[model samples]
Target: MLHIFCPHCGELRSEEEFHASGQAHIARPLDPAACSDEEWGTYMFYRDNPRGIHHELWDHVAGCRQYFNVTRNTVTYEILETYKIGEKPQVTADGKQTNAPSTVKGQGEKV
Candidate 1:
């Protein structure tokens, strides 16, 4: 029942319209042959589930069929921003202002 914002469509939609692909912004090993098992395991299992704000990758399964980032409040379920694949997350150019994206209505409660 979560509402996910589609960066491509600029619409908030039900969670059903989206699919969690996995962790986003993962840096792949530049030299896989040089990596140890421990290093690979660390990359695979470690996650930063911070309490206040978090960035995640989500796919607009039913909408744009594209993947985007979402900045949401973990505790309040408030989405701070939803932006295109490579664009900034609604941040000011000077990086001083912080504006959370507004929620669109008629969507389910979760997402």
Candidate 2:
């Protein structure tokens, strides 16, 4: 079982206590009212399902009932680190120090 650290609870808890929402740090359209149908559709439906290091939004459903960000390695199922929603991640696939979300090239292959 994956042990996840809840930034709100400040304790490491089992994965059962949390729920993975989806990819994190997605920017909402500046003007939803002005967005084209295709643009809105893409924004609402499309998400980065990367194979390497991925930033995710998780909720401590059975614990603090708060949401946070998780930087994880999808290939190894490793929990790299967890932070509050507004905070940036410390690790990336590029090996450069950055908080921005890392981008991978392929679909199902490991980076």
Off-target runs (Cα >4 Å) in candidate 2 are 99-111
Taking the tens digit of each residue's C-alpha lDDT, what string does model 2 give over 2-97? 778788877877788889999999899999999999999999999988887888899999988999888788888877778887876777654245
Off by over 4 Å in 1: 90-111
Task: Give me the displacement of residue 26 in model 1, in angstroms.
Answer: 1.9
Candidate 1's displacement at residue 61, Å, is: 1.3
lDDT of 1 by residue, 24-100 (tens): 56788899778899998888788777776666778888887998877666687766666665654553323343565
Worst 10 residues of 1 by lDDT: 102-111
Backbone clashes in model 2: 0
Candidate 1 overall lDDT versus native: 0.66
TM-score of candidate 2 on Cα atoms, chains taken together: 0.84
Superposed Cα deviation of residue 8, candidate 1 (Å): 1.3
